[model samples]
Target: MDARAEHDSDTRAVSRAVSELARRTRFPIAFGGLAQGGAIHVSSIVGARTRSLDGLVVQETRGLGGRAFAEKRPRLALDYRTSRSITHDYDGQVLSEGIATLFAVPVLVSGRSRGVLYCGSWGQAGVGDVVARPAFAVAEELATELRVGEEVRRRLATMPPPATSDAMAPAMQEELRESFAELRSIASTVTDTAVRERLTKLEQRLAALSRPAGPAAEFDVRLSPRELDVLACAALGATNAEIAAELNLREGTVKSYLQSAMGKLEASTRHAAVAKARRAGILP
Candidate 1:
């Protein structure tokens, strides 16, 4: 995808995360945005009574959100109007929304801050473990989405265009298989339903890339998610033990998944199962 399309996709992920933050924490107000040009430009908001938060841009070291972004940690203002620890650069917009207390969490991906998320209330409320946990979870979820997108884009950049002939280059096929396995590994750990769905779509795209030319084949087999995950890892020449370690599954469990997938694909061996899956357009 182009840069503009990528940006829009990231923004949509952030917007969904902000909405989830509000729903999970029961916060009356939630708004957040991704970093661009060293600033967090607020792009998503929920449960706000006014347009004060619209077009809000937070720079590093400038306000509560900025401090959280710069420090790569969560910051809380039990009393927003009287907080001395943070600068009041955005108070005009913040206070206008009657947000008496605010909590800011930086969306950190691979140890770098990609964005900041904020949840607020109309009354003074201390952010204990109960309120803080869901906000952190939401930020982590968004961070995972950003991380996956970055990896996908990086892989796409290095990949060659689709082949005209029936056979793809061996190196290109290996890269696609690796990408498919990595995406499946990441998808296994994601808890959010929407994010998992997005990852699944990306997985499908990767699978379609290596699809055989000409009319599609008719296959009656359907592999479970775990079965597909095991098969994808196996396609990368990963041993059952190695797949277990990567997927946090027991060695026997990994074997079981692989055997199940092979049975479904009507293959006699793991290698055969992977080959059949690729031919069926089930793995990239």
Candidate 2:
């Protein structure tokens, strides 16, 4: 994808993250935007009661969201109107929305702040682990999406166009496999339905790109998501323990999934199972 497409994807990701934040934390309002020119330009909002948050631009260290961005961590103002720790730069917009309490979490990627997500309520609400954990998960999911996009774009830039022959270059095939595995890993961890669906589509595209230039192999087997995840990691030569750790499953569970996948593919070993999956277009 080009720079414009990448920007649009990033924006969509931020929008989804904000929506998920609102749903997960049960906040009355949620909004956020990606960093541009060293500031968070609010672009997406959910559950807002008015137009007060529209077009809101938050500068680093200037407000609640800004402080989160500057510190690369979450910040909260229990009483927005009388908060002494943060500047009231966006109070006109925030207060106008009747948000008495506010929380901000920065989308940190690669140790740098990429943007900020804000959740607010009409009344003061204590942000305990229940609320904070999901907020952090949403931010981390968005960060993972951003990081994956960057890696894919960088690899594509260095890669040559596909050849006319049926076979792909060994190095190009390896890169595609790596990207496919990474996308699967991310998809397994993502909770938002829309984001997960988008990742699934990307995974399909990568698999299609890596297929040989001929009629696709006709196969009737369907592997479950966890089975696919385990297979993808195995394709990268990861052992059962490594796949277990990466997928956050027990080693026995990973082995079970692998064995099930192997049976579905009628393969006697994990290596054979991976090869069969690739041939069946079940993997990249």
Candidate 3:
């Protein structure tokens, strides 16, 4: 995809994510990608139509999402709309959404916090681990996808111009696709999310190399990269603990990502998720 098309895809991906998250967790979900001046700007949401969250500027360390991004970890408050745990910069929106409890998770990429992913309830103390897991998993997947896009652009920038028409030939495309498979094979041995994200980017870059570089394929639906990983392993008949060991996360965490993925895929079981993802071209 060209730069402009890629940018649009990223926008759609984030926008779609909030709605998908809201549906999956049955809680109001919101997302704010980091922008200049070190602030996260809320631009997309689901189940928050009552609030004017669009362009709601959240300064660093100023709100729940801010604290999560600043601390590079998940932050939670049982009664956010009136809680003293965080500043009230965006409480207007929260109150508008009728959120009495809330939680935020940082979208960390390459050791840097890129933004915040949040979900909350209209009642006090309404969220718990089972609800939070898929949300965090979705955040992780977005971080990974963004990091991959960045790396692809970086690598393309470093490459010299094409010397001839043969530069992007079909034969070369096949070779690049092979490299993608190899990278996935190597990445399975890695454990760290950040590191695996880099490899995933490399694989994505290779796959892109195999396709025409004119424009990105129209991808209207957003899928979690981390979800695909877990589901892909499950497709291979790996157990939850085994997937967790390979992904360098706790077994329960793996389950949450899987559940979130299943919701996104509209599947009721691991096998069903794998099948749906395959049909959706989110898996191979």
Q: Which segments of model 3 are wrong by more than 4 Å?
A: 1-6, 166-284
In candidate 2, position 1 carries an lDDT of 86
Q: Which candidate achieves the best TM-score against the true structure?
A: 1
Candidate with the larger lDDT of 1 and 3: 1
- Candidate 3 on 1-284: residue-level lDDT in tens? 68678767666657766665676677755555654378987767776656556667788888888888889988988887567878888777777767777878888889988777778776775567677877876776677667656755654555455446646644443344333433454465554465576566655545445344355434444656666667766766789998787777799998998899888767799888866654444543
lDDT of each: 0.91, 0.89, 0.68
Q: Tell me how far the alpha carbon of residue 231 in candidate 1 is from the true structure, in angstroms, after superposition.
A: 0.9
TM-score of each: 0.95, 0.86, 0.60
What order do you get sorting by TM-score, best first?
1, 2, 3
Candidate topping lDDT: 1
Residue-wise C-alpha lDDT for candidate 1, range 83-183, written one tens digit per residue: 99999999999999999999999999999998999999999988888889999999999999999999988887887764657787877888888888999
Candidate 1, residue 101: how far the Cα is off, in Å = 0.3
RMSD (Å) of each candidate, 1 decimal: 1.5, 2.6, 11.7
- State the lDDT at 156 in candidate 2: 72
Q: On residues 209-268, what C-alpha lDDT tens digit does candidate 2 reach at each position?
A: 887667777879999999999999999999999999999999999999999999999999
Query: Which 10-residue span in candidate 2 carries the lowest summed lDDT?
Result: 158-167
